[model samples]
Target: MTTRRSTLKLLAAGSLPAMLAMPAARAQQPLLRQLAIVVAFPAGGATDAVARLVADGLRGKYAETVIVENRVGGGGRIGAVHVKNAPADGSVMLFGPAFPMAIFPHIYKTLPYDPLTDFVPVATTSKGAFALSVGPAVPASVRSMADFVAWTKANPDKATFGAPPGGGQHFAGALFAKQAGIPLQMVPYKGGAPSVVDVLGGHIASVVTPLPEVLQHVKDGKLRMLATTTERRSPFTPEVPTMKELGWDVVFQDWSGFLAPARTPADVVARANAAIKEAVASPKVAAALQAQGTDVDINSPADFARLHRQTWERYRDVVRSTGFKAED
Candidate 1:
């Protein structure tokens, strides 16, 4: 018994040297190269703003150069494809909305790439609620959800609304139509800014879009908000009600985040995710997002991935329930 005990202790003592050397091996490797943040939307949009904020945060923590490149087109598919095909190194990251990750594939007939197979979800940085607003030409009495639904039902084809192509805004309108059991002719714009312009110009009856993009028009009375898309009213527009609270069936928001190519190194993903968490926690960045009526959500890479899968699954069901056929 004594000999066996001595032998076991000796064996245990010999393994300590190897365990100590393991950390040194990791330390010897070079730090990650400069990061390239790819934004699918055009510069000056919410996605661009969020990406720049994250990049600035990463710059504060890491010595590597961080560059944000806007690759706007095809409703994020183009930039998404660009990142998916790029080197799987930690250097290339995509900053955009959940559409590219979750909703796009279910909608389009032929997507350029497979979201699940091509990219890895890093984090869901922020989300902003959608607002139901009317142009200056509309009646102010149409402020409540009840009033808005009644008006749309009575007007029918007269209720022309504009939304970005194949986005949360479009789905918001569809859900609203489905709940109210009324038809709303939705006009498709390439982006939110154009739709905001059309609504403010009285070219459309109303516009359902992210609050940050259309808040200014609402403040200036060019547009009047009827309700928000969530179950709760936004603090930015506290007076506005919600579709669910009003007994409707629409819950939609514009959410943005980061994703890297699949098979990125664990160390690199960890480093990138750490930088992202720090960025979203920064007071300056939080304030900026809050000012735009966005809620910052900085989660670990694993949590973000879980949320990514959950959101995609939910929306996939929503898309399938809508019976929206694949567009050619």
Candidate 2:
């Protein structure tokens, strides 16, 4: 072995420095060489937006290559089944809405996979509260939730709100009406984005949808946000009160989580959870998600699993209350 003086000279020669840095470089290596984040919807939708941002955040950090693969079909069932059949490694994860786990079984008579058994919770990526926003169809005077209620009572025929069929918006609207004791009408749309189109054109009085889909219009004064369905005020629109805050029992919030195929090793699950938390907690990533009205509500595996179970049970009642019978 070289003496201390010789070691110092070797360091000065850059040989020892290079050798020492190798461990650090290796330690910094990403957990996976490739990670496929599967989104059930097509590109450019709100869910896809969340998936893309997360994939970008994971790049060079969680995995050397992170890609969002859109596996659209069967109202998210196709992608769910795809991920369920994927390898039980950390190489693939499903980044989709909580509906497939929490709501689908109630709606569909036969699902390709058992959500409870086919996947294990990885972590929650984002949460969004549904909002009731009024457009020009309602009098400009109707600004607050109370005002909207009174207006609907006054003009019973015009108390319609555009909502997608059999989704969070539809259920949130139904639950809100039941709690508020108002008989608001629902004008169905194929999707959340299209539902806002009619409300924007003043074809419908308002639209109950995820806040992100209508946030811009509300900010632009094209649509006035009356209330959100979350238990608390939304972080994106803190000034707007929630239905619960306004004395209505309407408390509904939507969240998206990542799930890996069942039997993924516990260690792999833990590491994936850590990676997602770090990736989402990054300031830039958090800001971008917030800008899209998606809160980076990172959840630990255990916490997420608990929440999933609660939602799964809660929606079973909620769906029954709505009296919606799916044909398929």
Candidate 3:
């Protein structure tokens, strides 16, 4: 009994710093007023592209400079860790995607940072859905998910699916395979662009991807859309059937959102959040997002936090059910 009490006291003592620092940390904002927005993935990707757009839109909205820095490495873990460890002054923020923010914790055994404990949600800039698209060489009549599944089974070794490794697109393919009761040979590519190349060049049967990456191909008849992963139909592509509409009961969406280091001051977070909301609400920004087939969903901090939680929970369940490994 005495030893137990002593150990408890020692543990309490060790946590003193966190307890004591809370008050001081909340007292005042840090000196650096400028905001550094970190993008985990390489330039030209969806997250990077959206971060640049938000930065550009905030030009006259805030008094301080809002600079976007691309910290590309380790499938977005590097940049996410950088933001997690950055000073919680609200000056350093990160634009996180599905990988680091939602999918990493489930797959990685020991992550350098914690998504819930290390970051505070600010706002969700945009949300988009995924689609299964077949290249021009594939039969144009392959319009339904079941039809595609049948074709894959008929030509088991011959059919190929291209997707970016460890991305939501890859997960989409995996989930589709699991649900449709078919086996697909996923061919991992460097990025979505390369994956699209393989699909368009007749190298792969189909590619699962966010609408922005393959919207043109579908419209131009270079690719055929089988189904969308959106809960409902996408506003841009109402003609495309969703997995849910087809009675599959699967819904997945890709989102780009802003997150600051945990414990950033309320005022700072509010300021950043307000700027983001304004940026997304702008006509030009809204138009740009629509152009990419992404919905301009600028949610409040609390609502965005809820969405973040839901995303993580859904993917975590997938990891657990599939016994996914963290080898990457």
Task: Report each candidate's C-alpha RMSD, comma-separated, in the order given.
Answer: 5.1, 4.9, 11.3
- Cα error, residue 159 of model 1, in Å, equals 1.4
Off by over 4 Å in 3: 1-34, 63-65, 326-328
Q: Name the top lDDT candidate.
A: 2
Candidates 1 and 3 compared: the better one by lDDT is 3
Please provide, for model 2 over 123-156, each residue's C-alpha lDDT reduced to its tens digit, 9 standing for 90 to 100: 9988887899999899998878888889989999
lDDT of 2 at 284: 83
Q: Give the lDDT ranking, best first.
A: 2, 3, 1
Per-residue lDDT of model 1, residues 1-328, tens digit only: 4477766775778964665588999765564558889998777666777788888888746426889998977878888989998888878889887876788878988988887778887777887778878986567777666777788888786787787667777788887777677778789876677787888887888887778877777787778888888767888888878888888778876468888898987777877787788888889988988887788877778887877788788888878766777675
TM-score for each of the candidates: 0.86, 0.82, 0.83
Q: Give the Cα lDDT of each candidate.
A: 0.79, 0.84, 0.80
- Evaluate model 1: give its lDDT: 0.79
Task: List model 3 lDDT by residue over 1-328, tens digit each.
Answer: 4477776785778965665588989864443447788987656655666778888787666535778898876767788889988999777889856667788788877878888878999888988788988886567777777788888888788667887666777777787787777878789865576778878899889998778788888888888888899988888899989988877756778677999999998787887888889988889888887888888878889888888888889888876655568763
Any residue pairs clashing in model 3, and if so which?
A: none
